[model samples]
Target: MKKDQNDRDSAIIIPFPGLKDRYYEKGISSLESHHFQEAVDFLKQAYQMDSTDPHISAAYLAALYENGNYDDSKRMAEELLKSGIGSFYDVLDIYLMILIQLNDYKQVVATLKPLFEENEIPPEKAEHFLQLLKLSEKAVRNQVMENSPKDDIPFLHQEQSPQDQLIGLGMLKDKNIHPYLDSLIEMLSVEKVHPFIKTAILSLFKENKIDQSILVEKLGKKETLNPMDIPSAEEFPFFHLVKNQMESQLRDHNPVLLEQILDMIERHSLCLYPFEWEPTNPSVWTAAYRAMGYELYGENWNLEKLAEFHSVQEAELGTIFTFIVKLEEISSAIVSPQ
Candidate 1:
């Protein structure tokens, strides 16, 4: 897909003898195609050849920004501004954007206020800058309020437990939290830690899209297997029978069978009503159905509608659905009270 024209325009292309034209063209093509990593790779080559070229630097910065490498992008933008190579307003715009993503609101205010006072902002961009300025000021105020000292007497103050502190730290929105993530992860991985605290830490990592394989290993759990590798109904006679019955009902389009399968699932405690599960062992089909069902219906689930929304063929959906049911049954049986 072609990137928006504004993004293309934001990639300022200054010419330099050292960097080959072909590299610049390839970099721009990758950026247009929305292949950000490829764009970064190409643009970095072009940049190394001629670091002084504003156009090359800008394109590299944009690629870094697109790839969520805000720190690198910010550094490149600052370098460009310091060198006085690119259009000042353009470099400042990219710098401001990086600051916003990094949540350095105070720096944003500091950076923009001078530009605004000096009337350096172009007419078209003035309003956008003003909006960003206002937002930065508000964020700064909110940060002050969040960090303000409380007036409560020391004798009356209740101390938070280590687990509560971990949870609170995980929930904080400050950019300074980076310095503490490793320590928090270490604390969270201790086997003696409360399960709920471990869960909270895991959730925080998941929410930020951070890899948790290290923490997973530290917990002494077996490595997560590919869903396809998990044993299914073929290994369990009772589950196979249940699967056959569900398939027969689905083949007939008998909606009543939905309730029967749900009842079986509930009895086995394989899945909670409304279909939620930990992201652990299960067949691919089971995981797919659960994810699609949750996204479509959330807690208020409707299986038939979910199947329809995904345009799932009757046979395929039914097979997957039954497989999930059987998978859940096996899972519950393994963990159930003896």
Candidate 2:
């Protein structure tokens, strides 16, 4: 059984039994040559042949991210972290670069918090994270100011202890948590929160908090969405999964293709498709449709289009929603076809 599994796991080649050292060297060489995809494939083979090859797996993850295999890359990174090996820190260091490109600040913060808690970070490494956190803090603030300020509050982790809170809050406050501003108010409301922390948070919130009723009126309150309707990232498909499906739909535009796309939108609880329609590559038409907010997640949709499509039947929404479900379900079924 062991021999059969090993044979099955080995990378196929003309000779049928490729030397492990040769494949490992080739993968490293491919990475140096900037052949990211080829390097990923070869490194993956080396990984399978010897799961102990920590360096190979790290290199594979780098190549995977560079080659735009974000899902696999992320999975590999997470697997390394969870596998309880010292090498995962090295993998995470490289994975952070990809997260930066994806604008995934929340994940970066989450990943950083663990290392901070463990006090495992060196000064040079700590400085790099600090710089990234600064950029992320600014980006998040701009996003809130330009768009939905209320929505951004959810990204704040209320469960964090005072020490963990200080590191993240310091980043959020841009290193000057002084003089108390309205921004910190929401941070104070939690029960059992430290008095010092509460004082700091209360000062910020009091400064920023406007009259809720008046603000709502000024914003033109109509039918407000239930807070329960908000979609969390954890509840949706991985961003790359939606991106892959949307790209597939774009590559072939027909009613059948459109149906496939709509199916994907519906299945992922209407969240994944929103980001999917808007990819990193703007040259693709999917980005245009996504930018138009055709398949926005629960909310954060463009107002003009929302009005135009508001009266559109809920059944259509159901159809699209189920299409996504069907896509996931069907794909899984096929993989384990009965």
Q: Rate the local accuracy (lDDT) of all candidates.
A: 0.56, 0.50
TM per candidate: 0.40, 0.38
Look at candidate 1 and tell me the lDDT of residue 263.
Answer: 42
Question: Tens digits of per-residue lDDT for model 1 on 216-260?
Answer: 322234343222333332343444444444455354674343334
TM-score of 1: 0.40
Residue 18 displacement (Å), model 1: 9.1
Q: Give the alpha carbon lDDT tens digit for every residue of 53-132 in model 2.
A: 67667777778887888778787788887885446556777566566556577778777877778887776567556555
Candidate 1, poorest ten consecutive residues by summed lDDT: 149-158
Error of 1 at 195 (Å): 40
